[model samples]
Target: MKKYIIAGLLAWLPLAITVWVLRWVINLLESVFDVLVQGAAAILPLSTHDVLHQLVEIPGVGVAILLSLLLLTGIFVTNFVGQWSLRQWDALVSRIPIVKSIYTSVKQVSDTLFSSSGQAFREAVLVPYPHAGSLTIAFVTGRPSGTVAEHLDGEYVSLYVPTTPNPTSGFFLMMRRADVIPLAMSVDEALKYIISMGVVAPTAEGLASAPQTTRPAGL
Candidate 1:
């Protein structure tokens, strides 16, 4: 009986949450169309309002517009001038006081993970975390540097331990390269596995040829 209940829940939970969130977003966007219709009805001449009336009556067009806007925004930010402006904005934020500490740290981590040159999450690794004898999933976030590297005794690399169901947030740690086990999974596959809470593990082999040797201190 317990096994059946667990199995049924596993099948239904993801579908239920996905449908609910998508419907909520659609409804929110649809409200914008409703406002446009009400405004047109009050002010526009009947002849001009006819097209607005007809168009706003459609169910999902507002959602389509919202998605299109987001797509265009993404494209715009990827260009040279937009990228430069974004960097300048970040530089301004880094000059603030309390905000600077939080924002700069977050920006560094995000850039290291999401930037084109970021190697963080490029490889899946295994490391003991939280406690000894307990292995946890980690991603190689590159080597430590400056004072941090000097303070540590051995070759150290940064690793991120992503939490289950939310891979965007996690704990960062510096560990000896020799202690990490490189996993046989691509970054995308590892992400899916983490977000799905291990339910969607992929069988594709990417790290099959990786040697079992530990990583050096720097990287």
Candidate 2:
């Protein structure tokens, strides 16, 4: 009975979460359309206002319009004038006290996660972290640099150790390249492992083959 229950949950939990996320996004888009219609009703003729409100209320129209707007924005941002305008806005944000550090850190993380060339959190690695007796999965963010790099021994990699079930927060460590064991698993597989709290491990054939023997300290 317990095995069956676990299997059933494994089948339905992902679907439930996906549906929940989609519903939340759709509701948010609908609210945006509703606000636009309500705001326009303040100044427009009654007949035109009713028409716009009815159109906005149609199911899925808000999502369609939102996607179209995003497409248009993407096109605009790729052009020279739009790039210049965005740079000026970023510069203004940088001049604001306290806001610049928060904004810059978020922007850099986003770029590293989403951009084609950025290397942050790209590789899955296995390391003896927190202690020699235990192994932890970590993501290779990149090699450390500047003053931190100077302190680390030759060829150290910067990586993050995410906690089970909640991956958004985790520890950042700079481990020696020789000490860190690079995993064969992709970033997505590693995430699934962490999120499922070790319940879902890929078959050995699916994982990368690597030397996993841990050495004692001072050896």
Candidate 3:
């Protein structure tokens, strides 16, 4: 009986979690849609107010609209006029005092992480952490630059060592490029492995492809 129960739970748990997440996202989008509809109703004719309210009540409409908007925005941003307009908008935003600092920081980070040509978080590696004897999974963020590079002894690479079960919080370290072992797994697979606390192991192929490493010469 215990074995049967365990098997049933293993089958049901994933599906339950997936559905819960989808429901939460849908609810959030619908709430935003409702707010927008209400604002529109206030300014538009009373005859059209009922139609907007009715549209908001329809299920899945918000998700569809949001998806379409994203698609359109993506299409627009690829053209010449769109690129020019984006630059103009960015220039205006940069002139704002307090808001510019926050916006600029966030925009720089987003661009680095999302840009096709950027190298941040592109490779997963193994590096010694906490102590020389212990090793952990880390992502290669980039190489140290400017004044920071001058203080370092040898060729070094910046790494982000994420904690298990929560990849958002992690340690940042700079280690000799020779000391880190490159893994075959993609960034997404490595993230899943970290978030699962080693429960969801990488494929055998990925494991086989990782190069063996020795302790750094000084360590």
Best candidate according to TM-score: 3
Best prediction by lDDT: 3
lDDT of 2 by residue, 93-153 (tens): 9999899999989988888888889998788888787887788889989888999887876
State the weakest 10-residue window (summed lDDT) of model 3. 209-218
Cα deviation in Å at residue 6, candidate 1? Answer: 7.3
In terms of lDDT, which candidate is stronger, 2 or 3? 3
Q: Model 3: per-residue lDDT, tens digit, 1-219?
A: 999999999999999999999999989988888887888888899999878877987889988887788899988988999999989999999999999999999999998899999999999988878888887889999999999999999899999999889899999999998898888889988999999999999898665434444445544
What Cα-based lDDT does every candidate model obtain? Answer: 0.80, 0.84, 0.88
Query: What lDDT is reached at residue 53 by model 3?
Result: 75
In candidate 1, which residue ranges exceed 4 Å CA deviation?
Answer: 1-14, 24-66, 87-106, 165-169, 192-201, 204-209, 215-219
lDDT of 1 by residue, 1-219 (tens): 999999999899989999999999789988876786788689888887777777787778877876787798778889998889888998898888999999988888778767987786788877777876576678887899988888899778898899989887999899887878777888888788788887887786744525745642333
Q: Model 2 scores what on Cα lDDT? A: 0.84
Q: How many backbone clashes does candidate 1 have?
A: 2
If both were scored by lDDT, which would come out higher, candidate 1 or candidate 2?
A: 2
Answer with 2 or 3, whichever has the higher TM-score. 3
Order of quality (lDDT): 3, 2, 1
